[model samples]
Target: MNTVPVNFDFSVSSVEVARRLIGVTVLVNGVGGRIVETEAYDREDPASHSFAGPTSRNITMFGACGHAYVYRSYGIHWCLNFVCREEGHGAGVLIRALEPNTGIELMQKRRGMETLRLLCAGPGRLCQALGVTREHDGMRLNTAPFELLLPDQPVAEADIVAGARIGISKAVDIPWRFGLAGSRFLSRPFGRSHK
Candidate 1:
């Protein structure tokens, strides 16, 4: 079913929708590479995490728009987001890390580990090397093959670099986390001692 091209357009330009989602490619079909290292959760500020509005596990971040909001952090990690403002507005953008490309032996046997940059880097190791659970909570990021591909060179807001958010304690200062600076598959830099 690899015909590609389904992008459920969401009226882009949220900071170019977070720097056009860097080298876009997040394949987890059979499990492997599709390098992705995202992190841009800004919704007119208020220190996001849906800025305390939609309940019931962030009601798919207010629904409609390119969805997919699997949550479950600190209770044993499982955070993968991408539901940006539109249907009702709440905003999203938190993939975190990935760079497997095409099933590195089922992502090193589901991240049992053998080092491949410790498989996926962050966001709970890219949702445990792309098995993204919590029942794929609120899926709809363009469907089939769990999609989100738009690369060809599109990550440059001066190469991005925002702060805050990482093991959050709440609002920390609201710098709106974003990355890619020296991207070794970012997500492990937190608030830099508040600069």
Candidate 2:
């Protein structure tokens, strides 16, 4: 693939950014892979962390775009999100899953498993496999330990799938989830009419 001098313009809507991230490569210290699944959330969305306004945990989401908003999920696993929209917009795209393409051995070791498909199949799992933690929060995506490389070409719209986000009680029907079509690495399969 052709590597170009490009940066993700996170000043757009979270849904737009999430959909466009399908084929991008997210390497956390050279350990990530093609982005396969993502979910979008905005300040107005009830399911968004910023819906209730900025808090200590979600302040990063209100900061400048193109920054990391890492947070712990269920008091256990850490989840990674890319802050999007304009400054103080409080929008972000959650990186739900990835197709492991680099540092396979290291990822397997970190996750304590050898299954390739299972290594980065979920947000928490992906974070664990790539060593993403609180330290990565508020960090610039273009800086060290965070290399978000654009795809050689834009991913075709026909090759993408959309669906409702997973594991959320509110806004359960909003079609904010996006993923590469037929990607086995998705956190979960898209449901009917979700495309």
Candidate 3:
């Protein structure tokens, strides 16, 4: 796999940067996988967490780039987001799913099932499978235990699909959700355009 540049440019729009994440490898511990789905959220976007401004829970979102903005969703499952949009920019690219690459046994064990389709198929499930939680909050992606490595070649643009963001009540019309076209690992509603 080709690794992305050490100095990942984060000064661009989240939409453009989000596309760079496709086909990248996300390694946590001995487990690893290729990112297949993601959602871009900008601080100025009403549908984003930082739109309301940073607080204790979202402070990491306002920190340096490439850090993790992990948080619990619905007070139950942890979801992982990579901080983007330049330094001190409150935005992120939500990792919605992964295509299991390494440590399949570990992933299956953590998920309590053998079905590949169901494992790491959603944001919460992927985090659970990779042991990502609040403990990894603010962790830099350039280090071990948690890293995002770009491939030698990225997914072709023709193979990617963009649509409205899901699981949000606001900014419902924003076409910030992106994923590998027709990938089975994508979360539901990914194909649904903003209505």
What TM-score does candidate 1 reach?
Answer: 0.32
The best candidate by TM-score is: 2
lDDT of 3 by residue, 107-156 (tens): 99999999987789889999999999899999877776776677778789
| Model 3 misplaced regions, further than 4 Å | 1-4, 192-195
Q: Tell me the tens digit of each residue's lDDT in model 2 across 61-171.
A: 999998999999999999999999999889999999999999999999999999988899999999999999999999988788888888779899989989889999999
lDDT (C-alpha) at residue 140 in model 1? 70
Best first by TM-score, ranked = 2, 3, 1
> What is the C-alpha lDDT profile of model 1 across 1-195, one tens digit per residue?
332345534545334455466566766565645444555565555656677678887888778757678889878989887777577777777777766677777777787886776588787877887888888778675665576666666665666676765656656666556666666656565345221
Supply the global lDDT for candidate 3. Answer: 0.83
Q: Any idea how many clashes model 3 has?
A: 1
Off by over 4 Å in 1: 1-27, 32-40, 46-63, 68-81, 88-90, 98-102, 106-114, 122-139, 147-172, 175-186, 189-195
Instruction: Quantify all predictions' global Cα lDDT against the true fold.
Output: 0.66, 0.92, 0.83
